[model samples]
Target: MATPADLPDSVYLEIFSYLSVRDRIRSSRVCRRWKRLVDDRRLWRHVDLTLYTMRPKVLWHLLRRYMASRLHSLRMGGYLLSGSQAPQLSPALLRALGQKCPNLTRLCLHVANLTMVPITSLPCTLRTLELHSCEISMAWLLREQDPTVLPQLECIVLDRVPAFRDEHLQGLTRFQALRSLVLGGTYRVTETGLESSLQELNYLQRLEVLGCTLSADSTLRSVSRHLRGVRKIRLTVGGLSAPGLAALERMPVLESLCLQGPLVTPEMPSPEEIVSSCLTMPKLRVLEVQGLGWEGQEAERVLCNGLPHCSVIVRPCPKVSMDWWM
Candidate 1:
């Protein structure tokens, strides 16, 4: 019946900015100035309720009272303070919305049932933090978030997180405008605490780890000597060992390298013995090998020997077969 105060205020704040706090309390009965413009704090910037509703803390006290001055960005997994049954966040409502959301930046917490993250109760004005399946301590998030003098942090996506420790390793060497870091489902990890957290990410270039567990091989060759401005390195060394493939020959501008693993035996090495030990980097172009156990003449002699330059791609894993890459 198009009621809700004849739908204005920019179409009821763009339809109560995508409802779902049980339909913003059943659209506040469409009256009394649309329930004061649905408890206007400019109809809350962006607060998605994570669905499994029943009035999660009265929608977290409607974001800790009267839309805590039009909060910035807050996307949770489900409710109380982050789903999966929602609970931990009541240290006085995370210290009164971490002392009233000073334009809180972006917090997309998924949920893993806590390990740490009181975030000293927030207000560092975060830039981007996306942690899915979080059971974080990340050394109490580098001693309660500093982000290099809080200069609008760059990016951090810890997906599938198992555990992140190594007490700040020099505060990730002072972010200094970090680029991109993604650790996807890293399994059973230890590699000397990811080689001193990879030389403090000295302005990290771009790196991704999927299912890793690296540790020895001279601590992954001293964690590949800080990957000299790494250009792109994705890995899946499934159970990782053998000096973690000799620590990718210490990354000298590693152009590209992707490896997905499980085994083809001899403790898995033959993608032409890992491109003849990364042919001394010199800016490698590309080399992708995914569960190589179908051999194809040793994956075509590890993609035509010496890599000829680089650009090599192999995807044959299909749950391992073909005589297990003879």
Candidate 2:
């Protein structure tokens, strides 16, 4: 017999927390009390505006009002399609955000333009930065700036960033706290670049490289010798090579490995060869092979035979989904 308005402020805020940003905006119109409860900063701690299309001013206003000193994680931006100028985070807005949200630790930007913002202007508290399909000069990040600007930064994910080249790796060495790195769909990085840069990452524990050439014997050998502390690795192997497999055996602390892309090629090692090589990896526990066709089962069986203590998982790659924006 009690109306929804009869719920306490705490209950109303909890309910608002469960609603999406759009739905929460609608609920705010219910009443003054509801509006105030919906505006609570706790609900805006993890803001995700990736699906929304709004002007820069609107986003800035929202951040100033709701996210100041409250936001911890933020994901923004959308696909930059042809003939459409979408709203983007500008340099001034980024500087304001850094000034307002000093506690923000994680940030992900997709298809956003950060070419104008200086890396030193970013929040110093950030620990993780993911930039997917974005336009930003790597030189800004690599330039000689105060190391204290991003002292806590540890994890960096650069996916499909055309501007990210092998030279950028030299800049990353400046981040002494870096621990995890993912370089996917970066065509410019060759085996030589990876070998040269990886030696400086003494503290790196997790590494992933996809769609880049890594078939050379010397490349894998260098990886084995320098990255002795790596615990997890993911690679896109179009054709499995003996030297690549040998590198896996050298990582004494390696626990999880994901090998994706084509498993069988004319020049690749045989299933038996792969299985035999894996036996040298004593501490490996999880092995995942993806993007295989009908031959996945056979590969899984052979891998399991050699690494009896490790769990092997094989699955076909999923179809790519397309998204269209109006």
Candidate 3:
């Protein structure tokens, strides 16, 4: 019988693949051979430090040790302590990351402060970028030179990022390859910004605009007119209008529609009107109405009865607490 130490490096690597990052790190301390196997570039392809709260310097040190050219995705979370300042991401650390991880494609930062960092500091190879409750500088996005913008970015998620505004929306039009976009808790975005952005993002397939002050003019008219190719859309806005509902019927490819937020108003459309609009949509498969009060359940019943093939969901709006940002 062969001893465990007799196992080949490939065998050790295969075993390491099944272990979590922390477990892999612990395994490295077993022996020199295991340490070397753990350091292999393949094992570091996707690094997630979302649960760890460390200083920027400490994170940089770890990245320098394990990060390799094979690294593609990185997820990090900043410390959100009460009355204590969170660790700031330094420009030097990002520059080094870009240089070391040339193939890095996905970058997710939660509760981070990127106010001092410029857009150019991010890896150019990134295809998916997510920033949740982050303080990103608006000027950082606008100031980037035309040549160095994230050219390959396909998906972007900005949730509860109070720093992002209308100008940032206009600036994001440069990313012509964008496919999926999620904007949540970004209250400042208005009809003008969204309309202009929608017109530019021709390739966008999925769009979610939550916690924004919008009405039929923004969600219905502009989106239906410009985003005819969009397959899925989630909008949190004010009461619906007749012309707006009519405009929504223009989308030839809409498969999923989610109307969220405190949408019950005096101008709110009736269950019959909404059900009539859904009947006209040939491709619509999923219809969800949240925060529409009593009408939501009524519409759900009507939708299920009318469109037997479609899925209908009705629910109250979720309450957002101030602590959620932290």
CA-lDDT, candidates in order: 0.61, 0.74, 0.78
Tens digit per residue, CA lDDT, model 1, 240-321: 5555676777477878776666533456565556766788678888887776554466576657567888887776644521
Candidate 1 backbone collisions, by pair? 191-214, 191-215, 293-325
**Candidate 1 segments exceeding 4 Å error:** 1-57, 60-62, 66-75, 79-100, 103-106, 111-125, 133-153, 158-178, 185-208, 212-227, 230-236, 239-244, 251-326
Candidate 1 lands at a TM-score of 0.29
Tens-digit per-residue lDDT, 1-326, candidate 2: 99987888888777788887778878888888878887888898988887787677778788877788989998888436523466557767777778899889988888877776677767778998888888777655673666676888899988888888778776788899999888877777777778778889767988877666555344456668788888887777664677667766747888887776663566566667766766777778888776755344676777777778888887765344111100
Evaluate model 1: give its lDDT.
0.61
Best by TM-score: 2
For residue 182, model 1's alpha carbon misses the true position, in angstroms, by 1.8
lDDT for each residue of candidate 3 in 1-326, tens digit (9 for 90 to 100): 99998888888888898887778889999988888899899998988787777777767767778876878898887654423566667778877878888989999887877878888888888998889888887675562457557889888888888878888887777787788888887888887888887788767889887766666445778777788888998877575665577778747899998877585566666667777787888899998877777554555687678777788888787686322321
Model 2 TM-score relative to the real fold: 0.87
lDDT for model 3, on a 0 to 1 scale? 0.78
- Residue 44 in model 1: lDDT: 73
After superposition, which runs of candidate 3 have C-alpha atoms over 4 Å from their true positions?
1-20, 30-43, 79-86, 241-243, 290-299, 313-326
Estimated TM-score per prediction? 0.29, 0.87, 0.81
Best by lDDT: 3
